[model samples]
Target: MSSTCYLSLDWPTAPAWVNYNSLQQLSYFTTVFLAAPLALLTGLGMSPALSTRFRRISKLVSIQAARSLHFLVLVWFLVFLVVHVALVFTTDLQSNLNQMYAARGGDGWTGLWVFLASMAVVIGGWIAATPFTLRRLRALPHHEQITQHFCIQGWSGVTKWGGVSMRTILDLVKPRPEAKWVVFYSLGDGPDKWRYYDAHPIEQMSHRLTMLAYDMNGRPLSFGHGAPLRLRNEVQLGFKQVKWIEGIEFVADFSRIGGGHGGYNQDHEFFGYHQAL
Candidate 1:
Protein backbone atom coordinates (compact mmCIF):
# COMPACT_ATOMS: atom_id res chain seq x y z
CA MET A 1 0.00 0.00 0.00
CA SER A 2 2.82 2.43 0.82
CA SER A 3 4.54 1.73 -2.50
CA THR A 4 1.31 2.17 -4.43
CA CYS A 5 0.50 5.38 -2.56
CA TYR A 6 3.92 6.79 -3.45
CA LEU A 7 3.29 5.86 -7.07
CA SER A 8 -0.21 7.37 -7.21
CA LEU A 9 1.19 10.80 -6.30
CA ASP A 10 2.61 10.74 -9.85
CA TRP A 11 6.14 11.77 -8.97
CA PRO A 12 7.77 11.28 -12.37
CA THR A 13 10.73 13.23 -11.08
CA ALA A 14 11.88 14.74 -7.79
CA PRO A 15 11.64 18.51 -7.52
CA ALA A 16 14.31 20.85 -6.15
CA TRP A 17 12.06 22.88 -3.85
CA VAL A 18 10.65 21.75 -0.51
CA ASN A 19 7.02 22.21 -1.52
CA TYR A 20 7.35 20.00 -4.53
CA ASN A 21 4.55 19.50 -7.02
CA SER A 22 4.04 15.91 -5.90
CA LEU A 23 2.15 15.39 -2.69
CA GLN A 24 3.50 11.83 -2.65
CA GLN A 25 7.10 12.90 -2.14
CA LEU A 26 6.04 15.26 0.60
CA SER A 27 4.26 12.39 2.33
CA TYR A 28 7.21 10.04 1.96
CA PHE A 29 9.78 12.53 3.20
CA THR A 30 7.57 13.74 5.97
CA THR A 31 6.92 10.20 7.18
CA VAL A 32 10.50 8.98 6.78
CA PHE A 33 12.36 12.11 7.83
CA LEU A 34 10.33 14.81 9.54
CA ALA A 35 7.65 12.85 11.39
CA ALA A 36 9.89 9.96 12.37
CA PRO A 37 12.54 12.28 13.76
CA LEU A 38 9.92 14.27 15.59
CA ALA A 39 8.52 11.08 17.20
CA LEU A 40 11.96 10.12 18.41
CA LEU A 41 12.63 13.65 19.55
CA THR A 42 9.28 13.72 21.29
CA GLY A 43 10.18 10.74 23.44
CA LEU A 44 13.49 12.41 24.12
CA GLY A 45 11.69 15.65 24.89
CA MET A 46 9.52 13.85 27.44
CA SER A 47 12.62 13.14 29.48
CA PRO A 48 13.33 16.86 29.90
CA ALA A 49 13.51 16.48 33.65
CA LEU A 50 16.36 14.04 33.26
CA SER A 51 18.20 15.16 30.13
CA THR A 52 18.94 18.79 29.33
CA ARG A 53 19.77 17.78 25.76
CA PHE A 54 16.24 16.47 25.41
CA ARG A 55 14.84 19.64 26.85
CA ARG A 56 16.88 21.73 24.45
CA ILE A 57 15.67 19.83 21.38
CA SER A 58 12.05 20.00 22.50
CA LYS A 59 12.37 23.70 23.27
CA LEU A 60 14.07 24.44 19.97
CA VAL A 61 11.59 22.57 17.76
CA SER A 62 8.35 23.93 19.28
CA ILE A 63 5.95 21.14 20.28
CA GLN A 64 3.11 22.54 18.17
CA ALA A 65 5.16 22.56 15.00
CA ALA A 66 6.40 19.03 15.54
CA ARG A 67 2.93 17.74 16.29
CA SER A 68 1.38 19.51 13.30
CA LEU A 69 4.00 18.14 10.96
CA HIS A 70 3.54 14.66 12.30
CA PHE A 71 -0.23 14.75 11.74
CA LEU A 72 0.05 16.29 8.26
CA VAL A 73 2.49 13.65 7.10
CA LEU A 74 0.35 10.84 8.52
CA VAL A 75 -2.79 12.15 6.83
CA TRP A 76 -1.01 12.55 3.51
CA PHE A 77 0.40 9.05 3.65
CA LEU A 78 -2.98 7.51 4.45
CA VAL A 79 -4.81 9.40 1.71
CA PHE A 80 -2.22 8.43 -0.88
CA LEU A 81 -2.18 4.86 0.34
CA VAL A 82 -5.97 4.53 0.00
CA VAL A 83 -5.88 5.91 -3.53
CA HIS A 84 -3.02 3.60 -4.42
CA VAL A 85 -4.90 0.58 -3.06
CA ALA A 86 -7.99 1.46 -5.07
CA LEU A 87 -5.87 1.77 -8.20
CA VAL A 88 -4.21 -1.57 -7.55
CA PHE A 89 -7.64 -3.16 -7.38
CA THR A 90 -8.32 -1.44 -10.70
CA THR A 91 -5.09 -2.42 -12.51
CA ASP A 92 -3.07 -5.61 -13.04
CA LEU A 93 -2.80 -6.27 -9.32
CA GLN A 94 -1.64 -9.90 -9.45
CA SER A 95 0.89 -9.33 -12.25
CA ASN A 96 2.24 -6.24 -10.54
CA LEU A 97 3.01 -8.22 -7.38
CA ASN A 98 4.06 -11.46 -9.10
CA GLN A 99 6.81 -9.49 -10.84
CA MET A 100 8.46 -8.88 -7.47
CA TYR A 101 7.99 -12.43 -6.21
CA ALA A 102 8.87 -14.06 -9.52
CA ALA A 103 11.84 -15.90 -8.06
CA ARG A 104 9.92 -17.11 -4.99
CA GLY A 105 6.79 -17.99 -6.89
CA GLY A 106 4.21 -19.69 -4.67
CA ASP A 107 6.64 -19.48 -1.75
CA GLY A 108 5.55 -18.54 1.77
CA TRP A 109 7.42 -15.22 1.84
CA THR A 110 4.41 -13.35 0.48
CA GLY A 111 2.12 -15.04 2.94
CA LEU A 112 4.56 -14.29 5.73
CA TRP A 113 4.64 -10.65 4.79
CA VAL A 114 0.88 -10.56 4.87
CA PHE A 115 0.85 -12.13 8.32
CA LEU A 116 3.46 -9.69 9.64
CA ALA A 117 1.57 -6.72 8.25
CA SER A 118 -1.57 -8.01 9.93
CA MET A 119 0.27 -8.24 13.23
CA ALA A 120 1.57 -4.70 12.81
CA VAL A 121 -1.99 -3.50 12.31
CA VAL A 122 -3.29 -5.32 15.34
CA ILE A 123 -0.47 -3.98 17.48
CA GLY A 124 -1.26 -0.48 16.22
CA GLY A 125 -4.53 -0.75 18.17
CA TRP A 126 -2.58 0.96 20.93
CA ILE A 127 -3.13 4.34 19.25
CA ALA A 128 -6.53 4.50 20.97
CA ALA A 129 -4.79 5.29 24.25
CA THR A 130 -3.20 8.40 22.78
CA PRO A 131 -4.38 11.81 23.94
CA PHE A 132 -5.62 12.77 20.45
CA THR A 133 -8.04 9.82 20.24
CA LEU A 134 -9.44 10.73 23.65
CA ARG A 135 -10.21 14.31 22.60
CA ARG A 136 -12.13 13.26 19.48
CA LEU A 137 -14.14 10.66 21.45
CA ARG A 138 -14.94 13.14 24.19
CA ALA A 139 -16.17 15.65 21.61
CA LEU A 140 -19.76 15.10 22.81
CA PRO A 141 -20.65 13.61 26.14
CA HIS A 142 -24.10 12.47 27.24
CA HIS A 143 -25.42 14.53 30.11
CA GLU A 144 -28.54 13.49 32.04
CA GLN A 145 -28.68 16.88 33.70
CA ILE A 146 -28.88 18.65 30.35
CA THR A 147 -31.67 18.03 27.80
CA GLN A 148 -29.74 15.81 25.37
CA HIS A 149 -30.46 16.87 21.80
CA PHE A 150 -28.47 15.54 18.89
CA CYS A 151 -26.54 18.57 17.59
CA ILE A 152 -24.64 16.86 14.78
CA GLN A 153 -25.22 17.63 11.07
CA GLY A 154 -27.11 15.06 9.06
CA TRP A 155 -29.47 14.64 6.07
CA SER A 156 -32.06 17.48 6.06
CA GLY A 157 -31.35 17.95 9.77
CA VAL A 158 -34.05 15.42 10.54
CA THR A 159 -31.67 13.11 12.42
CA LYS A 160 -31.01 15.23 15.46
CA TRP A 161 -28.42 13.52 17.68
CA GLY A 162 -24.90 13.86 18.99
CA GLY A 163 -22.33 11.55 20.58
CA VAL A 164 -22.94 9.79 23.87
CA SER A 165 -20.27 8.78 26.33
CA MET A 166 -19.08 5.19 25.99
CA ARG A 167 -19.24 4.77 29.72
CA THR A 168 -22.69 6.29 30.01
CA ILE A 169 -24.21 4.09 27.29
CA LEU A 170 -22.43 0.98 28.47
CA ASP A 171 -23.75 1.62 31.92
CA LEU A 172 -27.29 1.57 30.47
CA VAL A 173 -26.81 -1.90 28.96
CA LYS A 174 -24.34 -3.48 31.25
CA PRO A 175 -22.49 -6.24 29.45
CA ARG A 176 -21.86 -9.66 30.89
CA PRO A 177 -18.69 -9.84 32.94
CA GLU A 178 -17.29 -12.39 30.50
CA ALA A 179 -18.22 -10.27 27.50
CA LYS A 180 -15.08 -10.41 25.43
CA TRP A 181 -15.95 -7.71 22.92
CA VAL A 182 -18.11 -4.60 22.53
CA VAL A 183 -19.79 -4.04 19.21
CA PHE A 184 -21.03 -0.74 17.73
CA TYR A 185 -23.47 -0.82 14.87
CA SER A 186 -24.10 2.01 12.39
CA LEU A 187 -26.74 1.18 9.82
CA GLY A 188 -27.35 3.91 7.28
CA ASP A 189 -30.11 3.76 4.69
CA GLY A 190 -27.44 4.12 2.03
CA PRO A 191 -24.42 1.86 1.54
CA ASP A 192 -22.91 3.22 4.74
CA LYS A 193 -23.67 0.32 7.05
CA TRP A 194 -20.81 0.09 9.53
CA ARG A 195 -19.94 -1.89 12.63
CA TYR A 196 -17.23 -1.08 15.18
CA TYR A 197 -16.11 -3.71 17.69
CA ASP A 198 -13.38 -3.59 20.32
CA ALA A 199 -12.01 -6.33 22.54
CA HIS A 200 -11.74 -5.69 26.25
CA PRO A 201 -8.67 -5.63 28.59
CA ILE A 202 -7.15 -3.21 26.11
CA GLU A 203 -7.95 0.49 26.43
CA GLN A 204 -8.58 0.58 22.70
CA MET A 205 -12.18 1.61 23.36
CA SER A 206 -12.30 5.38 23.81
CA HIS A 207 -14.93 7.35 25.71
CA ARG A 208 -16.27 8.91 22.51
CA LEU A 209 -19.67 7.73 21.36
CA THR A 210 -18.61 8.11 17.73
CA MET A 211 -14.86 8.03 17.81
CA LEU A 212 -13.58 4.42 17.91
CA ALA A 213 -9.97 3.69 18.69
CA TYR A 214 -8.74 0.62 16.86
CA ASP A 215 -7.73 -0.83 13.50
CA MET A 216 -10.08 -2.96 11.41
CA ASN A 217 -9.20 -6.17 9.53
CA GLY A 218 -5.47 -5.57 10.00
CA ARG A 219 -5.62 -2.01 8.68
CA PRO A 220 -6.43 1.34 10.25
CA LEU A 221 -9.92 2.66 9.54
CA SER A 222 -9.81 6.01 7.66
CA PHE A 223 -11.87 9.16 8.20
CA GLY A 224 -15.51 9.30 7.05
CA HIS A 225 -15.29 5.57 7.77
CA GLY A 226 -14.94 6.50 11.44
CA ALA A 227 -11.23 7.04 11.39
CA PRO A 228 -9.04 6.91 14.48
CA LEU A 229 -11.66 4.37 15.54
CA ARG A 230 -12.57 0.84 14.66
CA LEU A 231 -15.75 0.40 12.56
CA ARG A 232 -17.37 -2.84 13.73
CA ASN A 233 -20.47 -3.50 11.59
CA GLU A 234 -21.49 -2.36 8.14
CA VAL A 235 -22.64 1.28 7.67
CA GLN A 236 -26.21 1.61 8.90
CA LEU A 237 -28.88 4.15 7.86
CA GLY A 238 -28.69 7.16 10.15
CA PHE A 239 -26.43 10.20 10.65
CA LYS A 240 -26.66 9.71 14.38
CA GLN A 241 -24.84 6.39 13.89
CA VAL A 242 -22.02 8.05 11.97
CA LYS A 243 -20.59 9.49 15.15
CA TRP A 244 -18.24 7.53 17.42
CA ILE A 245 -19.52 4.55 19.40
CA GLU A 246 -17.95 2.12 21.85
CA GLY A 247 -20.54 -0.57 22.58
CA ILE A 248 -23.77 -1.98 21.16
CA GLU A 249 -26.93 -3.36 22.76
CA PHE A 250 -29.52 -5.55 21.07
CA VAL A 251 -32.91 -4.75 22.54
CA ALA A 252 -35.80 -6.83 21.26
CA ASP A 253 -38.28 -4.10 22.13
CA PHE A 254 -37.96 -0.32 21.99
CA SER A 255 -41.46 0.65 23.10
CA ARG A 256 -40.43 4.12 24.15
CA ILE A 257 -39.21 4.98 20.64
CA GLY A 258 -41.53 2.53 18.88
CA GLY A 259 -42.70 -0.96 19.86
CA GLY A 260 -40.34 -3.66 18.56
CA HIS A 261 -39.06 -1.12 15.99
CA GLY A 262 -35.80 -0.18 17.63
CA GLY A 263 -33.31 0.74 14.94
CA TYR A 264 -31.91 4.01 13.55
CA ASN A 265 -33.91 7.01 12.30
CA GLN A 266 -33.93 5.84 8.69
CA ASP A 267 -34.94 2.30 9.59
CA HIS A 268 -38.28 3.47 10.87
CA GLU A 269 -39.02 6.26 8.40
CA PHE A 270 -37.90 7.44 4.96
CA PHE A 271 -35.67 10.03 6.54
CA GLY A 272 -32.82 11.62 4.64
CA TYR A 273 -30.44 9.31 6.40
CA HIS A 274 -31.00 6.65 3.77
CA GLN A 275 -30.93 7.03 -0.01
CA ALA A 276 -34.10 6.52 -2.09
CA LEU A 277 -34.31 3.05 -3.57
Candidate 2:
Protein backbone atom coordinates (compact mmCIF):
# COMPACT_ATOMS: atom_id res chain seq x y z
CA MET A 1 0.00 0.00 0.00
CA SER A 2 1.15 3.54 -0.74
CA SER A 3 1.88 5.99 2.15
CA THR A 4 -0.89 8.25 0.81
CA CYS A 5 -3.43 5.48 1.51
CA TYR A 6 -2.66 5.79 5.23
CA LEU A 7 -3.53 9.51 5.17
CA SER A 8 -6.91 9.20 3.44
CA LEU A 9 -10.11 7.44 4.52
CA ASP A 10 -10.44 5.94 1.03
CA TRP A 11 -10.03 2.18 1.03
CA PRO A 12 -7.38 0.84 -1.31
CA THR A 13 -8.32 -2.31 -3.22
CA ALA A 14 -6.45 -5.22 -1.65
CA PRO A 15 -3.86 -6.96 -3.82
CA ALA A 16 -5.12 -10.20 -5.42
CA TRP A 17 -2.71 -12.37 -3.36
CA VAL A 18 -4.17 -11.21 -0.02
CA ASN A 19 -7.84 -11.54 -1.20
CA TYR A 20 -9.33 -9.27 1.54
CA ASN A 21 -13.15 -8.95 1.54
CA SER A 22 -15.34 -5.90 2.38
CA LEU A 23 -15.35 -6.63 6.13
CA GLN A 24 -11.54 -6.73 6.21
CA GLN A 25 -11.35 -3.46 4.27
CA LEU A 26 -13.72 -1.79 6.73
CA SER A 27 -11.67 -3.11 9.65
CA TYR A 28 -8.47 -1.72 8.20
CA PHE A 29 -9.99 1.69 7.60
CA THR A 30 -11.47 1.88 11.09
CA THR A 31 -8.21 0.84 12.72
CA VAL A 32 -6.11 3.33 10.80
CA PHE A 33 -8.39 6.37 10.91
CA LEU A 34 -10.83 5.99 13.79
CA ALA A 35 -8.98 3.81 16.29
CA ALA A 36 -5.64 5.64 16.00
CA PRO A 37 -7.12 9.10 16.54
CA LEU A 38 -9.36 7.88 19.36
CA ALA A 39 -6.35 6.39 21.11
CA LEU A 40 -4.44 9.66 20.90
CA LEU A 41 -7.43 11.67 22.15
CA THR A 42 -8.04 9.34 25.08
CA GLY A 43 -4.34 9.31 25.98
CA LEU A 44 -4.36 13.11 26.20
CA GLY A 45 -7.54 13.08 28.26
CA MET A 46 -5.88 10.74 30.78
CA SER A 47 -3.17 13.27 31.59
CA PRO A 48 -3.56 14.66 35.11
CA ALA A 49 -2.47 18.08 33.97
CA LEU A 50 -4.85 18.17 31.01
CA SER A 51 -7.80 16.61 32.82
CA THR A 52 -7.43 18.86 35.81
CA ARG A 53 -7.02 21.99 33.71
CA PHE A 54 -9.74 21.12 31.23
CA ARG A 55 -12.52 20.11 33.59
CA ARG A 56 -15.27 20.39 31.00
CA ILE A 57 -13.44 18.04 28.66
CA SER A 58 -12.60 15.77 31.58
CA LYS A 59 -16.27 15.65 32.55
CA LEU A 60 -17.17 14.63 28.99
CA VAL A 61 -14.47 11.89 28.71
CA SER A 62 -13.65 11.25 32.40
CA ILE A 63 -10.15 10.20 33.43
CA GLN A 64 -11.24 6.64 34.26
CA ALA A 65 -12.94 6.26 30.88
CA ALA A 66 -9.88 7.72 29.16
CA ARG A 67 -7.70 5.12 30.90
CA SER A 68 -10.04 2.30 29.86
CA LEU A 69 -10.12 3.51 26.24
CA HIS A 70 -6.33 3.75 26.21
CA PHE A 71 -6.08 0.06 27.19
CA LEU A 72 -8.59 -0.90 24.49
CA VAL A 73 -6.52 1.08 21.99
CA LEU A 74 -3.49 -1.02 22.99
CA VAL A 75 -5.50 -4.18 22.32
CA TRP A 76 -6.54 -2.86 18.94
CA PHE A 77 -2.92 -2.11 18.00
CA LEU A 78 -1.86 -5.62 19.08
CA VAL A 79 -4.58 -7.22 17.02
CA PHE A 80 -3.68 -5.08 14.02
CA LEU A 81 0.00 -6.04 14.37
CA VAL A 82 -0.82 -9.75 14.39
CA VAL A 83 -3.05 -9.49 11.33
CA HIS A 84 -0.55 -7.27 9.53
CA VAL A 85 2.39 -9.65 10.10
CA ALA A 86 0.35 -12.70 9.09
CA LEU A 87 -0.71 -11.03 5.86
CA VAL A 88 2.86 -9.90 5.11
CA PHE A 89 4.25 -13.45 5.49
CA THR A 90 1.36 -15.05 3.60
CA THR A 91 1.45 -12.67 0.62
CA ASP A 92 5.22 -12.14 0.03
CA LEU A 93 7.46 -12.33 3.11
CA GLN A 94 10.77 -11.55 1.40
CA SER A 95 9.48 -8.45 -0.39
CA ASN A 96 7.88 -7.02 2.83
CA LEU A 97 11.01 -7.70 4.91
CA ASN A 98 13.30 -6.20 2.29
CA GLN A 99 11.23 -3.00 1.96
CA MET A 100 10.98 -2.47 5.74
CA TYR A 101 14.43 -3.60 6.91
CA ALA A 102 16.78 -3.01 3.98
CA ALA A 103 14.78 -0.30 2.11
CA ARG A 104 15.05 -2.25 -1.16
CA GLY A 105 13.39 -5.03 -3.14
CA GLY A 106 15.33 -8.26 -2.60
CA ASP A 107 14.98 -11.92 -1.48
CA GLY A 108 18.23 -11.93 0.59
CA TRP A 109 18.84 -12.88 4.26
CA THR A 110 20.32 -9.40 4.84
CA GLY A 111 16.88 -7.91 5.51
CA LEU A 112 15.97 -10.66 8.02
CA TRP A 113 19.26 -10.21 9.88
CA VAL A 114 18.77 -6.45 10.07
CA PHE A 115 15.22 -6.94 11.45
CA LEU A 116 16.52 -9.31 14.18
CA ALA A 117 19.30 -6.90 15.17
CA SER A 118 16.80 -4.01 15.47
CA MET A 119 14.60 -6.11 17.78
CA ALA A 120 17.65 -6.94 19.92
CA VAL A 121 18.52 -3.25 20.31
CA VAL A 122 14.96 -2.46 21.42
CA ILE A 123 14.93 -5.30 23.96
CA GLY A 124 18.37 -4.36 25.29
CA GLY A 125 17.33 -0.72 25.79
CA TRP A 126 14.25 -1.74 27.75
CA ILE A 127 16.33 -4.06 29.96
CA ALA A 128 18.87 -1.32 30.68
CA ALA A 129 16.20 1.33 31.57
CA THR A 130 14.54 -0.25 34.63
CA PRO A 131 17.21 0.46 37.29
CA PHE A 132 17.70 4.08 36.26
CA THR A 133 13.94 4.73 36.44
CA LEU A 134 13.81 3.22 39.93
CA ARG A 135 16.78 5.27 41.12
CA ARG A 136 15.17 8.54 39.91
CA LEU A 137 11.93 7.77 41.72
CA ARG A 138 13.75 6.81 44.90
CA ALA A 139 15.68 10.09 44.93
CA LEU A 140 12.52 12.16 45.56
CA PRO A 141 12.57 14.43 48.64
CA HIS A 142 10.80 13.81 51.99
CA HIS A 143 9.03 16.04 54.53
CA GLU A 144 7.21 16.11 57.94
CA GLN A 145 3.63 14.82 58.48
CA ILE A 146 0.41 16.80 58.83
CA THR A 147 -3.10 15.29 58.84
CA GLN A 148 -5.77 17.12 56.86
CA HIS A 149 -8.87 16.84 54.68
CA PHE A 150 -8.28 16.24 50.95
CA CYS A 151 -10.92 16.69 48.25
CA ILE A 152 -10.82 16.10 44.48
CA GLN A 153 -13.66 16.25 41.97
CA GLY A 154 -16.57 14.86 43.99
CA TRP A 155 -14.50 12.72 46.34
CA SER A 156 -13.37 13.67 49.83
CA GLY A 157 -10.98 11.97 52.21
CA VAL A 158 -9.00 12.61 55.38
CA THR A 159 -5.36 11.63 55.24
CA LYS A 160 -2.11 12.27 57.07
CA TRP A 161 0.11 14.26 54.67
CA GLY A 162 3.76 14.61 55.59
CA GLY A 163 5.05 18.13 54.89
CA VAL A 164 5.74 21.55 56.29
CA SER A 165 2.94 24.11 56.61
CA MET A 166 2.91 26.76 53.88
CA ARG A 167 2.78 29.40 56.59
CA THR A 168 5.91 28.07 58.24
CA ILE A 169 7.83 28.02 54.97
CA LEU A 170 6.61 31.49 54.01
CA ASP A 171 7.88 32.79 57.34
CA LEU A 172 11.37 31.51 56.54
CA VAL A 173 11.36 33.24 53.15
CA LYS A 174 10.20 36.57 54.56
CA PRO A 175 8.05 37.47 51.55
CA ARG A 176 7.78 41.12 50.57
CA PRO A 177 5.26 43.07 52.68
CA GLU A 178 3.29 44.08 49.53
CA ALA A 179 3.15 40.63 47.95
CA LYS A 180 -0.48 39.56 47.60
CA TRP A 181 -0.22 36.24 45.78
CA VAL A 182 1.71 33.02 46.28
CA VAL A 183 2.80 30.95 43.28
CA PHE A 184 3.74 27.28 43.44
CA TYR A 185 5.84 25.61 40.72
CA SER A 186 6.10 21.91 39.92
CA LEU A 187 8.55 19.59 38.09
CA GLY A 188 7.46 19.05 34.49
CA ASP A 189 8.98 19.59 31.01
CA GLY A 190 8.22 19.95 27.30
CA PRO A 191 5.42 21.55 25.26
CA ASP A 192 2.79 19.16 26.58
CA LYS A 193 3.82 19.89 30.15
CA TRP A 194 1.33 21.93 32.19
CA ARG A 195 2.61 25.46 32.77
CA TYR A 196 3.51 23.85 36.14
CA TYR A 197 2.53 26.68 38.43
CA ASP A 198 -0.50 28.14 40.23
CA ALA A 199 -1.09 31.44 42.03
CA HIS A 200 -3.32 31.92 45.04
CA PRO A 201 -4.20 34.88 47.21
CA ILE A 202 -1.42 35.48 49.71
CA GLU A 203 -3.82 35.29 52.70
CA GLN A 204 -4.65 31.69 51.76
CA MET A 205 -1.07 30.72 52.49
CA SER A 206 -1.59 31.37 56.20
CA HIS A 207 -4.64 29.13 56.53
CA ARG A 208 -3.99 26.27 58.94
CA LEU A 209 -4.79 23.68 56.23
CA THR A 210 -2.32 24.98 53.62
CA MET A 211 0.68 22.68 53.35
CA LEU A 212 3.26 21.15 50.98
CA ALA A 213 3.11 17.37 51.42
CA TYR A 214 5.67 14.73 50.52
CA ASP A 215 3.99 11.72 52.15
CA MET A 216 0.38 10.57 52.25
CA ASN A 217 -1.48 8.05 54.43
CA GLY A 218 1.52 7.46 56.69
CA ARG A 219 3.85 6.50 53.84
CA PRO A 220 6.12 8.19 51.31
CA LEU A 221 3.96 9.37 48.42
CA SER A 222 4.49 7.19 45.35
CA PHE A 223 5.54 8.79 42.05
CA GLY A 224 2.14 8.03 40.54
CA HIS A 225 0.58 10.00 43.39
CA GLY A 226 2.97 12.99 43.19
CA ALA A 227 6.16 11.95 44.99
CA PRO A 228 8.42 14.95 45.60
CA LEU A 229 5.71 17.30 46.90
CA ARG A 230 2.03 18.31 46.50
CA LEU A 231 0.11 21.27 47.76
CA ARG A 232 -2.90 21.13 50.09
CA ASN A 233 -5.27 24.07 49.97
CA GLU A 234 -8.41 23.13 51.89
CA VAL A 235 -10.57 25.91 50.47
CA GLN A 236 -10.04 25.35 46.71
CA LEU A 237 -10.86 22.64 44.20
CA GLY A 238 -8.27 19.85 43.98
CA PHE A 239 -6.67 21.27 40.78
CA LYS A 240 -5.41 24.10 42.95
CA GLN A 241 -3.49 21.44 44.87
CA VAL A 242 -0.40 21.48 42.67
CA LYS A 243 1.71 18.29 42.58
CA TRP A 244 5.43 17.59 42.12
CA ILE A 245 6.09 21.00 43.62
CA GLU A 246 9.61 22.34 42.94
CA GLY A 247 9.49 25.98 44.11
CA ILE A 248 7.42 28.67 45.80
CA GLU A 249 7.34 32.35 44.90
CA PHE A 250 5.56 35.33 46.44
CA VAL A 251 4.17 37.78 43.89
CA ALA A 252 1.99 40.85 43.85
CA ASP A 253 0.06 39.35 40.95
CA PHE A 254 0.13 36.44 38.42
CA SER A 255 -0.97 38.42 35.35
CA ARG A 256 2.51 38.16 33.74
CA ILE A 257 3.22 34.46 34.15
CA GLY A 258 2.17 31.83 31.63
CA GLY A 259 -0.90 33.16 29.74
CA GLY A 260 -1.52 35.60 32.57
CA HIS A 261 -4.69 33.88 33.74
CA GLY A 262 -3.38 33.46 37.32
CA GLY A 263 -2.47 29.72 36.96
CA TYR A 264 -1.76 27.04 34.40
CA ASN A 265 -5.30 25.68 34.45
CA GLN A 266 -6.73 29.16 34.34
CA ASP A 267 -4.68 29.98 31.27
CA HIS A 268 -4.94 26.72 29.31
CA GLU A 269 -8.47 25.57 30.09
CA PHE A 270 -10.08 28.80 31.25
CA PHE A 271 -10.81 27.37 34.69
CA GLY A 272 -11.80 29.90 37.30
CA TYR A 273 -8.82 31.48 39.03
CA HIS A 274 -10.36 30.78 42.44
CA GLN A 275 -12.09 27.40 42.20
CA ALA A 276 -13.81 26.89 45.56
CA LEU A 277 -16.06 24.31 43.95
Best-performing candidate as measured by TM-score:
2
lDDT of 2: 0.70
Deviation from truth (RMSD, Å), model 1: 18.8
Give the range where candidate 1 is weakest over 10 consecutive residues by summed lDDT: 193-202
Q: For residues 1-277, what per-residue lDDT tens digits would candidate 1 score against the true structure?
A: 2456545665332123224346557666866887667666654433312122233454466434555666665676687678756544444444433434343333235644554576687778766444333455545452221122233353232212233344554554465655533334322212222121112211223333222333433444445556544332112323333334433433322322211123334333533322211
Error of 1 at 193 (Å): 45
The TM-score between candidate 1 and the true structure equals: 0.29
Name the runs in model 2 displaced over 4 angstroms. 1-152, 189-191, 275-277
RMSD of each: 18.8, 11.1
Query: What lDDT does candidate 1 reach at residue 239?
Result: 37
lDDT of 2 at 215: 70
lDDT of 1 at 135: 59
lDDT, candidate 2, 157-253, per-residue tens = 6677776677776766689998998887666432444346788888888887787776788787788677777788877777778887655677787
lDDT for model 1 comes to: 0.40
